[model samples]
Target: MTSPGSIRRIRRIDLRRSALTGGPVDYRRAVPRAEFDVEAAVDIVKPITDAVRERGVEAILEFNARFDGVEQTEIRVPVEVLHRALEKLAPEIRAALEESIARLRATCQAELETDAVTELGPGARVTHRKVPVGRVGLYVPGGLAPLVSSVVMNVVPAQVAGVESIALASPPQKEFGGLPHPSILAACALLGVEEVYAVGGAQAIAMFAYGVEASATTEGCERVDLVTGPGNIYVVTAKRVLKGQVGIDSEAGPTEIAILADDTADAAYVAADLISQAEHDPLAAAVLVTSSERLADEVEAELDKQVSVTKHAERIGISLSGSQSGIVLVDDVEQGIDVVNAYAAEHLEIHTQNPDVAASRIRNAGAIFVGPHAPVSLGDYCAGSNHVLPTGGCACHSSGLSVRAFTKSVHVVDYSREGLAAVRDHVVTLAEAEDLPGHGAAVSVRFSEPSPVESGETTP
Candidate 1:
């Protein structure tokens, strides 16, 4: 618990103007964000990836000893170890994880895409196919928290997408005798994932990108087609370095939550939600955008009351007071919507007169939580929505992890002789217009000669 005198203050940004004296407001600049520089970390992580590429599992073992301070002899966890972890898991926690898995599995099944065919002409048709990646590497962080829920979030989607192979990696915990946290292992067992590794940091990304060979004491890990999940700076930097070698979900940064509340919103709920995200990391962002000044004042007071007794008071206090966390005072709900869209938080909550209306207008945000009952914490675990999301205004262009991320879209074309004839002149004319006669020749050569079979002639 934090003492009253030591409590940090959350700053305010006033966006309400007396008169219309502006062109389009640059709401992006008005919002606060943490200084997350993945480029700066390239030099530190590149060496680790390069070593893993060159030395294989040997490099991973060396790094595990150096960085994680766990003298690990093997990289992969045995099958019996996974089963033992599950056997030892508490009944209540196991029940909760099972429920979360069921809900997420249902949602992923609903979101799975299917093939679609289109006929452009009498004999020409195209089929759009949804194909799953051959294999995927799911990285779960072991820092601060065990993140057992991450196992469910990453595995269920890849399974739903029908990925043939799935591998998971987490940092080796010294306290857990050089294996991943028992809870994470248990979740993996419950999800029926057999390939698990006790590796972490950028090396895990490199191991997935460049497959390691079998060593004296360890069975090597096979390369994966794609990698997904969240991590810290080193993990994000490694993804950037090895992006072309393998597919990556997103360069996830610190967690963040923004609440767009009005006078109708409850102050206690808003404050508690803000504190919940803050508990994730000291750098996590918690922003409040509202039209009611009185509500703002009440929420601030409620935060003080709540933070004084929370278990993670120091961490929550640091996050709430950081420059990345603050309150934005907008003139009204419309202006509030504009502000939140430009900010593009990872998680956005709408607590207004009509949460549905406010949520509909939101153009950005990795995920939107509507009404008082739908808190960001619910989405983090049991809301059936993915907890892995885009951060640092990335929602403006990217999206959260889902079954779609693990699948690829391919177009298959089928055409007959008559179909080619139907568009021969058009293809030739367009190819000639582009000054590439070879393109036209490829289509022209197919029809230049008639086959005996097509002419219905018999050879003696």
Candidate 2:
């Protein structure tokens, strides 16, 4: 239920001329935080993570029943059900998922890369090998939206990375016999991955990383090396707590997007982008830092018009009304860029005419979309780049999941006698300088014994 006043803030297109002034959005008061209790949620998740880590499969099952309302002793989702799921799906959804997968594949191919090798010295050479993790765990959020698009977003990149195994975990629906939505199961089958689990939350993450129950075992069953995708705060916390025991992608938080537009920008386009991100969850932050008061006014009006028609009208209303979402008028485009940089958003769209230049000036963002044509939604689905990204201001220091997220490098040594001799003095000098006599002794051992040729020289 969006209040009349809340709806009034949206500047409709009929009132478009109000945005031309190019004013400033108050940085201090742009968005509010009524229900985004990230700190509290993180605190609560620590216990859940520890419980799952200590109790393993049983704890996960308990959380599944408690949170998702589906109880199961084991976590496996059978193949028969998965096959039937596609048939049960509406044709429109089936077609959409198929198209999205194809589009995403093309995008991933462009972003994925292979490793390289180089030689530093005559005998010292190094090579980088792009090896995928033996196993990866993907947690898809289900409490709110079905997140069928997320199925493609996560698995495609891991598949592109050549990860040997991908284990998917989604909450079980009672209406579906604790099975994931048929669309999701169909997606798993479509991707050619067979290991699926009907589980969710912090517990599901634990089962994947720590290996719970006699349930998920295979012929060569083992714990996963890396876990990815998005979930609620509890899931994010579990990943944080268990990071040392297993690898984790960025710890995501409430979704957020920052749009930078100029006076020439379409108010409708700007408003739609902001509202789309807002609909993800009530806590998602949608911001437009623009140089046009008239544009802001019109976008606010456009938001009022389009928001009424959104499918998730309740969520859309809550998100739009939430303090975390609003239009900010900046002094100019340069100040807008600085505000965006300071925020370090997960998704950023530059809609100004010189979008490339604006994008170039951006210092921090998980993903950047340039021009009106490349909206954040494209990246969320069919854009070849990965969608799982660092969030909650973390883009300042981290990055999104990609092919490189699954690999690690270790130095290999292949020193020959000559190679060892070539660096003996340097090693000895450094070792002696560091007061490590044993290090020098180790290098000196090769020269400790005299060569037989010395005897011939003495006889001569």
Candidate 3:
């Protein structure tokens, strides 16, 4: 409430008055598809990544101190700081952290696949075993809110994948004395991560990629084999620049959601879910595809009415009205499916009759929700699916975080003398046909003595 003596501006908004809201229940013809342009974000990502490569860690730190407003000599969060976070965190926070540990661990255990072996023939064994990267770096955003869930999303998968060492980084908070938010540390502690960094933004990505300077000796460094998690555009750009040096999950982008609804869908529920994701960021996208013109009209009205009540109303408005987001009124469910596939949204929520059947048809999406009960927010917290997903239409080819992101497969080859003899000629023929005599020589060394002629065998 403003002070009585102070001048105050009172604003009023009624969604029913807006034209964007599908009104008068138009069913005569299919509404035009809402035009979505990807060029805008693509234009931003390239430069951001280029700048990170040219400027290196200094560039990253400048952006962090500039945007995040915390200055520090060292980028890595120290041991003492994380311990303090645990010491000072609230009890209820501890309870939630413990519960999250159990739930997320269960998800990881249930989802991860173990190593396998197959016998190609007698005396020959081919094995596929999951090998964790030697070192992994997990990024967590600490700007608007400390994404405690991200810490779990990243760490749990790495642990399940058997990553030897996991390092997590987040922006230092001026409000919290340049320490990562306590909940972030608590989540880390729950997973037994003693290595946490207070740096943030592209710099955090760089610190993990390039390693931080030693405050003590000023000569030592820490490096990682893979970097994972979601961050701002700058962070995404940094990942792009360092991709060749280290593995990255995906080129992260702004958050997004696409809700497919029918007449049976609750307009209020649809609007609420759309706004819920929109509140994430201005660049975030929220699209609603529906077969029912009536439900579309109602949802449009609901967006306005609902956005007014949310805490981040401006963010919701910007996300919902952004060029990438809008309501697509289709001819029917089939047409709606086509639109959604083209969009390839980060999150796809189906609020149609036989939602399971409709959801099963979706071939591209970072994550999915069925019916009114399963919202994207559930996935953000405790839905068992990793919330860190491919965004900005990246769902077209990418996927959400999972145990597989932390694990790599290394083929194990074992062959007995008989096994080698059985395929020796085949291997030698193919190797020679490839036009490199040295390729065949490696195997020929074993029988270079001409194999005693093998009782009428001839060397080709």
lDDT of 1: 0.94
How many clashes (backbone N, Cα, C below 3 Å) per candidate?
Answer: 0, 22, 1
Q: Across residues 28-135, which tens digit of lDDT does each residue of candidate 1 receive?
A: 888889879999999999999999999999999999999899997799999899999999999999999999999999999999988999998988999999999999
Model 2, span 186-280: residue lDDT tens: 88877777889888887777777778646454221247999999988888877877888889987888888889899989888887888788889
Of the pair 1 and 3, which is ahead by lDDT?
1
In candidate 2, stretches whose alpha carbon ends up further than 4 angstroms from where it belongs are 1-39, 90-92, 215-221, 450-460
lDDT by residue for model 3 (59-120), tens = 55566677778775566566766777777779887777667667877888887787799998
- Candidate order by lDDT, decreasing, is 1, 2, 3
Model 3 CA lDDT for position 131: 79
Candidate that beats the other on TM-score, 1 or 3, i.e. the better one: 1
* Candidate 3 global Cα RMSD: 6.8
Tell me, by lDDT, which candidate is best. 1
Error of 2 at 334 (Å): 1.1
